[model samples]
Target chain A: MRSLAILDSTLREGEQFIKTFFTLEQRVMIVRLLDRLGVTFIEVPSPVSSPETREAIEAICALNLRSHVVAHVRCVEADVQAALDTGVYGLNLFFGTSNELRSYSHGRKIEQIAHDAVPLIRRIREAGRYVRFSAEDAFRSDLVDLLTVFDAVVDAGVERIGLPDTVGIATPRQVDRLVSLIANRYPNVGIEFHGHNDTGCAIANTISAFEAGADCLDVTVMGIGERNGIASLSGIISQLYIHYPDLLAAYDLTQLVELDQYVADCLNINIPYNMPITAPSAFTHRAGVHTKAVLRNPHAYEILNPTDFGVVRHVDVGSRFTGRYAVGHRAVSLGLQLTSEEIAQLTQALKERAERGSLNDEEVNTFILAWYEEKGSLVWER
Target chain B: MRSLAILDSTLREGEQFIKTFFTLEQRVMIVRLLDRLGVTFIEVPSPVSSPETREAIEAICALNLRSHVVAHVRCVEADVQAALDTGVYGLNLFFGTSNELRSYSHGRKIEQIAHDAVPLIRRIREAGRYVRFSAEDAFRSDLVDLLTVFDAVVDAGVERIGLPDTVGIATPRQVDRLVSLIANRYPNVGIEFHGHNDTGCAIANTISAFEAGADCLDVTVMGIGERNGIASLSGIISQLYIHYPDLLAAYDLTQLVELDQYVADCLNINIPYNMPITAPSAFTHRAGVHTKAVLRNPHAYEILNPTDFGVVRHVDVGSRFTGRYAVGHRAVSLGLQLTSEEIAQLTQALKERAERGSLNDEEVNTFILAWYEEKGSLVWER
Candidate 1:
């Protein structure tokens, strides 16, 4: 009953951001990497954009990856036709519907917009391809309009419906209510959630969507996309793996970090050190008290061992919380041992040094060994 | 009325995650920086932890900072005594009550835990100091229990209550629901939202909490703290300044990027290029189409002008997307001009070079100028 599906939109949405353009070969290489990583779906470019997009899509279709290759298309006949020409495995048709978008940006009435979406869904479905219709800006759209569009698309034979916080404005409560409403009203259709990071809520909204019974999720590698970008693949996958491990069974959890690093390198972006599970600091410890507790029992601070994702727990002594265990461990590494009293004195000395912001490994070891020598309990190896 | 209140816990929660020990002077320096940055409150260390904390808190209090200094204390009698002894401006008392915490960690009855939080709130209130009672695992707590605990605290005269996603698990929907529930129930009380990034929903949760009527937010520079850390100050501030400018009137939006860079350097951590507002790539363009559009109109792809944050747009041409605009701009910058048709030809040649991943600025400019010269369009200056 559980499935792990990775829907990658690097070529379509990721290309939209930054000035780094990908050629047919680079695009093909990105797809190849996703396939090698065993992603469930690779979202290729919109074929309507340019001839280059058409060529990129056709080249990817030729790869015959075990993973499905989907094409992103606007909710218009012309765009859907372009997608069909690319021969993608599925079609992800999207359009805007928020008040600001409907009334100001697109200058279209909600009723007219909903009507426009239905035919596009039908056209894609009639082509015998799986269709996922997205209500762009759903977070800001009126509930009545959202539900009406969802109902229309479902009736039009859309296999899946995606609700996007195009401007990253939806909170988790809204996501819960909306997803729950759709799950209740359209039990036969798959529900997906696509989010932006305009307000940095992409991950939160996506998770809320899942809790409310979303069957699919949209994510970008390293969160590379427009504006603040989309929900990061690592962020969503780690959360699911940690809190809802039973929800996704096919993913190789161990390869998660590797896959993220690979994609980050390909994108030529440095991963944020505080980035959820992949950052170096994610598992490293430096404070004295926390390190002592960790030495006694790692569960004191570590929820999951960093090694689970191929990372190691690093204990640094340069912080204000340097603990006894970290100090003792450093002493051991330096080939020195002393009585508990001597160790206590060394700890106090190290604390003072840390307070002055002048503490270094060499200085710490020198102080520790000196204390041991003064106590007449020193044991030093060559 | 709108207010901008910053709650800084660099010495408390932030110190908890530091791998290196900081001196008392360094602690004071950070507090001074906070005061300089016009932070509303600074959360000092737990006095019960060690002599250094007590001394640092006492010293910081004596400095009489414009920003109020507070002590973080656990929901216990001894901890409260320790905090009171430090003579801080406020107390932040916290405890856990979620199923995961109560059953798996605390091993205490929920009722007993809830009762413990009330007395602590009363104790801080009776002492005539400001108080913020945080539900440590509020995100995962049952709605009934969460509401009951908040009601008890409010009835006991607690002024502010913080709803924390202690393990970084809540989505935006959950954040909005919790904030709305508390705001609606305790109309007069202050509600704060504290989020973690274990699930990468911290920023979104903070914004949702604001929309749901939370009065204050908890953030850290570079999102540094325990585990996946908390919501980033820069990310939240930039989003607010851009989309909800009216919500934070007193905050100096122009100082945001500079402040972020300063914090990163002080912490000795390099800012990630993809970090929301302050990232290098945040305003850099490298693709052909985007560069062309930007050259014609920066607003074509950019939502906000980079100069608003004291940054400028840069167009790099290393990737396959490097188009005619990049080439033409370079040619113009080199004091060379070609006919429109000749520029188109050179653009095509540059695109081919970019696709081959070997385009250099010198070589590209040389090829364009040579073609222009042969066509009698320009003469070489040197």
Candidate 2:
């Protein structure tokens, strides 16, 4: 089993969501909830970005939550000083190292970037705060440049060296190879992985990173961040809970759905129906074969228990895709002694009705009751 | 590069969505669009499930589109006959193989399952149609059971053998190992992979399976199947586009968003904001630093170009996360000659207002114009 820690950037990364705007109160609420939920770290936006940002960071730091409050800042003196003023327990200093970002973002050469980042790393370490120096587009940067820059910060006493797939371009294989390369090179330093979801591989890439020996992963609530956002907190948790349940023993697993709900409600966005554990359909069994097997034994078709997440499994027996077995099960559960033939007939009728459109729960019940009392004789009965 | 084929099960699996009930016309429309989108195969529910299902399958087969029509059936002679009657070009036969599913689902031993499946595979092959025998819950099944059943069917002339992570329990490494085991065992038989999204590792697992020599992958549009559906059509495309753009050359990539919208609309669900390529936020850059760099060069922060999916990149400059560079860029685009210092001040003010709540485009313009006129701005004075 791989050791892992969670760092939630719902405040810092989520603030970059197009619809997200965290008030000072909202920031405190989010941080408090995340801390209570057992997130290892809660990252807030750089204090240098705005006065409100600085104040929010300061207030969150003052709350003295069990979770470490991390200030995500740029690799510059002013940003470093601002973060220092926030009294954050940790600092995440980043600079774009990819050629595209180098030319258009800070316009700094590799040597200059390393030279500039080292002092901030030293300053943050001197202040007795855990510090991480990140290459913002590590996946796209020249490998040699990433090694040189990461080495400089590590030598400057940074505890963690960060690799971010800022563009969400890294595949699982690529993430594995890159993290393996870096992890092998810096055996003593902690590795942090920050990935975006541009290619829908953020969660997988994060898992790959951990498998390759990264210690911490950066994620955001509901995956809300710039562009398609970063790895989602719930997504990462769901993956771990399914494949490596022991690693998630420290987390309050039941709070995952509510956490997603809270963030989605705050953002005024609907959770996608396919979102790992929180989506409505995540545990809904509707297909005939699946419904049949799941009814008998949920483990037949479910990898995770919805009850574990404070969610219920819904079996849509009213859908046209439902089978005789499911209909039979539902009828028996409703105290009806329908035979297999009757169940098949009723299932056929319900399926035809479903072909036109969906039937409500009441409608399904009405159909079942009506069929039970109706005068029509089946071919077998005749 | 790996050889791959797409098997879309939107009609079959999507019908299992609690809210999804596609009419014959709707099914036909979906099949046509998928065919046009270069899907290699379209799998529909077995004809044994409902009359409408059979008719839909027949209609799709009659269209003679580029995509082959497949009937997803149970491992029973009756289901095989029903599927054969539908005129589908291919048949996907599945039965539970795991101890959990064996004891609870069909109450069949490995011998009974293999005995029942071999005849069906032979029968389907005799019909001169493509046949695939899948071991449901393959990941959880005892390896010997899977090998015995798969080998029996292969000997019985099944054209393809399927490995389904029925509960989405397999990790990428597990998937790779399993697929490699099967691929190595049956050197002549084609391998198919069907994965569920219960753990959000379906797409990555699919990629891993392909990397391990699986030839065909099962996907559904919007991933709307039972229990959070299967691997999403667009998600897989996004992964391939990111890591193997050459493989997606045959696909009508630009139609991905429309495909997602069509499915989501039909299901009456909002596309989750974090959906890979089609969600509204997929291309919306909100972080000030990201917006600044994205404006200069989109590749600086994006791995996949929005235009490739007929989508546009939106740089949100009014959000609190917006940086000085973004404010200056926006102001310059608006023909305002603000100095860097003034831009910084205005950005800070805007971020504060944003912290209170979001600012509309008009409000943002008003703030900028008012600040320009009322302040003793250095640029204006000059």
Candidate 3:
């Protein structure tokens, strides 16, 4: 279970997020952050596309971060050469294998694909570099065709294989079954799983893959990638830390929010409100009943403690849904003591104001202080 | 499998979204939209919180939509009376049963809670209104404690029992086990599931509950709730439509996008980029390799068709990753024929330009026409 390694592909797959264009400086910063965060591998764009892409890869590699840098390239010979020229630690070679891709993408049959990959695999290995041969749409590809390619690549000296749910078509059950099949067949080889979130199952599918014995999982920060992105790094961490802490022992868990903030700022996209642990409201208790309970004991309503990720808990006390208990707690915190009746009245006043919209802390405090004065509670001071 | 019912809590749970303050008119509009979308039940805020909450409930009930309107209230008699006064078709009574909530929230032990709920259940039943007794933190409650409370409520004439993963602490396996246990024990009772998305498993857990024989599942538009929201209505729909289309045949599936857009606009929040099926990027395919295959067969990259949801597919063709095939296809569509070598050169130029950032359609067309003219491609006219 602890064998799973993280391959942070934020620089590679995240570049595919709609309208995302990371500068060379942004790429270096992201790679440095991810490396310091202790991901095992950092997958970056290949040099095949442009001179700047190659420069970005070369700059990342030159940083000599703790993480091993890898490049994602197609199976074409020119791509392989460009990857080698980057002086990276490893190369991930991918090809379209599903029937739809086979018939239309490269227009290559299974035999032709397998035959073409052997020499590339041999060349990458001969250069004393790490290599992984991946089938682009492994889940949609025929099982026989996938195995044939896997077996051929292994014979040609490749030891790692990637199974990608390229179209995000896989369910968790399917992910588990496919991963277990690959694990059993390639007992000596490492299996990697890459999934997309088209149906909102990417995180679950990645979990299922790990549970079924995949050794590596692909993730992008905030799950940013093409078409709704892939499994999010923080989301995976949130799920695993609670159930499988040992797998993440090497990572600095507290830096999760910092990473999310940095990436969101760099990309100029707001951290989504529903982001698992780092969203502003992830730890906010708003409903009257929930605020009341969470005020009494955070455990009453919270399972993921905000403190674990360097975030503070916020109990909203200025809404129509704000309960008397939350208001009373706020009153006490502000150095005031109110009777039960006063507390109820204050809560009612706040709720009415909130019915029109939300109120800030200052307004809530003002209402409480005015209520105290109106009730003669501040008569001694006057 | 088709026994599952949708209890859309957009008005009830969605109100807990941070800063959400739906006016009476907004609440009525949302209720109308949901009713038109064909949810079996529409759950709304209880009247006990404020006069306006009750007014909102009354206004929705007055609409008399085809779906039943249920008010969510505490098990307290005053709350029950407030819900009853609203003239809602049903009442949902909830009590926190977990040790954390029992001690910190209501300070009632199992027997005390059971003793208190009997009269409220009896009163609701005597009023001839549909009533559901729910355990607020059912997932965290001791199994015996949960069964004890559930049994007491059933004995008190409550026909429906809700199992809420209140803190979002449940896994898929746990949801299945808990649902199966209650399902087997109380075959005559209705089982409803309300899950949260803290660990990003709300939809998965809800689906697991359904698979384990739950009769109903609670959802909010965009999964908006207190903290990271609940299971999204669209996420659940995306999962079910693929596996249980018969269950959702009654719904106007095309209205899903409209509903999401309306709610997002009302709340002034962007629909998250990863929102299942409705996000702008949900059907947008980028990546040169992906565009090529998607052009051949959309199924190669898309499992859910955009047409089904009144959306169109967008093939991103102006990125650094643009392939020659995608560019050449665009050239042909624009009535220009270029040699393979020229297409490759043009693709390279586009990639180089894209390294600075993304290009608009006009920019791409300008580059293509310039290249055609530069290559002296007026041969057809000559």
Highest lDDT against the true fold, candidate: 3
Where model 3 places Cα greater than 4 Å from the true spot, the runs are: A374-382, B370-382
Residue-by-residue lDDT tens digits, candidate 2, B1-382: 6667899998887777777877778788888789878988898888887677777777888898999998888888898998887778989999889998998788999999989988888788888999999998999999998899988998999888999998887888899999998999998889999988777778889988988989999999877777677788887888888677788889898777877888788877777776788888888888777778888888777777888889988777777776788778777767799888889888988887777777766777777788777775754778
Write down the worst ten-residue block by lDDT for model 2 chain B: B371-380
lDDT of 3 at A43: 96
**How much TM-score does chain B earn in each model?**
0.86, 0.94, 0.96
Better model by DockQ, 2 or 3? 3
Task: Give the per-residue lDDT of model 3 (tens digit) for B130-229.
Answer: 9899999898899899888888989888878999998887877788899998999998889999998888778878888998988889999988998888
Q: Is the docking of candidate 3 incorrect, acceptable, medium or high quality?
A: medium
Tens-digit lDDT track of model 1 for A1-382: 5444668877776765553366676677777766765677788767755566687788889989887999877676887888887779999887666665554344577778778888877777788888998877777778888888777788889888888776556656778888998889999988888877655667777887888888888887777776567788778877786678776565555666766676667667656665677876677666554566555555545556676677877666544456566777777787886566666667777776566563555666677667667656444442
Please, what are the lDDT tens digits per residue for candidate 1 over residues B60-178?
99999898988877788998988987779989887766766655444567678668877777777788899988877787788787777777888888888888877676767667777
Tell me which of candidates 1 and 2 scores higher on TM-score.
2
Q: Give the Cα error of residue B127 in candidate 3, in Å.
A: 2.2
Q: lDDT per residue, candidate 2, A1-382, as tens digits?
A: 6667799999988878878877778778888788877998899888877777788788998899999998888887888888888778988889999899999888999999989988878888888999988998998899999988988888899888899988888878899999999999999889999988777778888989999989999999878888778888878888888768898888788878877888888887777776788887788888777778888888888878888888998888787776788888878877899877788788988888887777766788888888886735443476
Looking at candidate 1, what is the lDDT of residue A342? Answer: 60
Better of 2 and 3 by TM-score: 3
Question: Which candidate leads the pack in DockQ?
Answer: 3
